[model samples]
Target: MLKIRNLSASIDGKMILKGINLDVNAGEVHAIMGPNGSGKSTLAAVLTGRNLYEITEGQVTYLGKDLLTMAPEDRARAGIFLGFQYPIEIPGVSMANFMRTAVNEIRKFKGQQPMNASDFMKLIREKIALVEIDTKLINRSVNEGFSGGEKKKNEIFQMAMLEPMLSILDETDSGLDIDALKIVANGVNMLKRPDNASIVITHYQRLLDYIVPDFVHILYDGRIVKSAGKELAVELEAKGYDWIKNHDGDE
Candidate 1:
């Protein structure tokens, strides 16, 4: 569903990603693991077209079209969902109204009629249940005064509502307790289909236990240094990222 080749990006004239290459096919989950400052989040930002990072080289094709050329909103409308590492708080807007507007906008982009109030309410209820999110929180402003776990679950809730084809979850497991982590992973697993894919970027291997990936890639120093199967995550857990740095002769 997504193809990236020799993709490099920079921000404020300092290059961050230096030649990233990967392929995410339908029905697959790819995990990106690395230490801090390794360009894991940079890859996600580049793919989602965050505007700050300029693509220095290479190409990214999503579903056979030039993904890097599309606007951020266009990417979202084209079924690209990015779960932020730090979800921002919108203090004045209710979650219901915010999501309703977003859903309708995507539908309009797809040339479909807007969902009616009754159907929208039903959909909202279903998604809230799917992610095990608190109903009371939905009536409040987006991420306003939410606990860390609550904010991450809210991100998954939005993901469920949008049903993006390529979901790029950047550190979705951050700050989540075991129970909250399980709930978030369950929601992501349940949302998986034969025609969609996920790129999970995380630092710890514990997240991989909950959301087992088809491929585990070690991203180091703005490039993917090693790619392996699910067992690679287990290896990384046992050996730690220092092993990766040493193996790559960084010292």
Candidate 2:
């Protein structure tokens, strides 16, 4: 569904990603495990057209379209969803209003008429049930005064509503108890389908236990140094990153 070739990015002229090449087919989950500042978040930023990062080189193709050339809104409309590491708080804007706007925007982009109040409400109700979010919270401001877990759940709630084909989860496991983690993971798993894919960027392997990936990639020094199956994640957890660094040096 997505192909990234020789993808390099920089911020303020300092290069961060060095020739990243990755491909995600439909119905697959790819996990990117790396230490802090290994360009994991940068990759997400570049893919989502965050505007802060400059694409020094490379091409990103999504669903046969030039992804990097598309605007942020276009990317979202094209079924690219980034579950942010730090969800922002939007005060004075009810979650229902915010989500309805997003849904309508995508619909407009696809040349469809805006959904009526009744139909939109029905869709929101079904999605809220999928994410197990309270209907009352949807009536409140987006992410305003929400607990950390609640904010993360709200992100998934939006994802469920959007039904993106390619979901890039950047540190979705950060700052959550086991119960919250399970809830979030269950939501992600339930949404997976044969025509969709996910890219999970995380620092720990614990999250992988719930959402097992088809491929595990280890990134270091702004590049992917090793790629393996799920067992590699357990090994990294056992031996730590230094082991991989030393092995890479020997190679």
Candidate 3:
């Protein structure tokens, strides 16, 4: 569904991603793991069309179109969803109002009529149950006064509702207890379909225990240094990132 070729990006004239290449197909879950400042989030930011980063060299093709040229809003409407690592608060905007607008906009992009109030509310209820979110939470302002776990669950809830083709979750497990983590991961698993895919970016192996990616990649020094099966994550957990650092120098 997505292909990246020699993707190089920079911020403020300093390079972050150098000669990075990746391919994500439908029905696949790929995990990106590395130490801090290894350019995991930078790659996500570049793919999402953040203006701060400049594409120094390379091309990104999504659904066989020039992905890098599309605007951020266009990207979202085109079935690309980025679950932010740090979900910001939007005061006074209730979740129902926020999502209703977003869902309708997506329909408009697909040349469909707006969803009626009755069907929209029914869809909302179904998604609320899918993410195991409290009914009252949807009435509250967007991420306003929400606890850390609540915020993360809310993001997953939004993802379930949007049903994107490519879901890029940047550190969705940053801060959460074991129970909350399972709930969040369960929602991701239940939402998985043959026509969809996910890019799971995380630092720890614990999250992998639940999501169980089809492939695990070790990114170091702004490039993917190693790629392997699920067993790679267990090895990384046992050996720590020092294993990668020591091996990276050898190559």
Candidate 4:
């Protein structure tokens, strides 16, 4: 569903992603494991066209369309959803209103009429149930005063509402207890389909245990140095990143 070829990016004239080549097929989950400052987040920002990063070289194709050329909203409208590590708070915007706007906007982009209030509400109710999110939270301002776990659940709620073709989860496992992590992972798993995919960027293999990846990639120093299967993640957890660093001749 997505193809990235020799992608390199920089921010404020400082290089971050050196060269990244990844292909994600529909229905597959790809985990990117890396140490801090290894550019995992930079890859997400570049894919979403977040504006801070400049693509120094290479191309990204999404469903045969030029993904890098599209604006952030366009990317979202085109079935790309990003679950941020730290979800932003919109103090005055109710979650319901925010999500309604997003859903209707994507619908309009697809040349469909905006859903009636009744239909929209029904749709949201179903999605909220799917994510096991509290309906009361939807009536409150987006992410406002939410606990860390609540914020992460809110992100998954948005994902369930949008039903994106490819979801980029940037450290979705960060700052959560085991139970909260399970809830979030279950929400993601429930959303998976044969035509949908996920790119899970995380630092630890603990999250991988809950959301087993089809492919596990080790990203180091702005590039992906090794690609393996689920067992690789367990090995990494046991051996730590130094093994990969040394294997890649970085130490």
RMSD of each: 1.6, 1.4, 1.2, 1.5
- lDDT tens per residue, model 4, 126-226: 88886677899999999999999999988998999998999999999999899989999999999999999999999999999899999999899888998
- Candidate 3 has an lDDT of 0.93
**Per-residue accuracy of model 3 over 150-229 as CA lDDT, tens digit each:** 99999999999899999999999999999999998999999899999999999999999999899998889888999888
Candidate 1 lDDT over residue span 1-251, tens digit each: 89999999999999999898899999999999999999999999889989889898999999999999999999999999999999999999999999999999999999999999999999999999988888999899999999999999999999999999999999999999999999999999999999999999999999998899999999999989999899999999999999998886321
> For model 3, what is the alpha-carbon lDDT of residue 126?
94
Tens-digit per-residue lDDT, 1-251, candidate 2: 99999899999999999989899999999999998988999999999999999898999999999999999999999899999999999899999999999999989988999999999999999888876778899999999888899889889989999989999999999998898899899999999999999999999999999999999998887788888899989999999988877766211
TM-score for every candidate vs. truth? Answer: 0.98, 0.96, 0.97, 0.97
Q: Candidates' lDDT values, in order?
A: 0.94, 0.92, 0.93, 0.93
Candidate 1 has a TM-score of 0.98
Model 1: residue 222 alpha-carbon error in angstroms:
0.5
Q: Judging by lDDT, tell me the better candidate of 2 and 3.
A: 3
Candidate 4 regions exceeding 4 Å error are 249-251
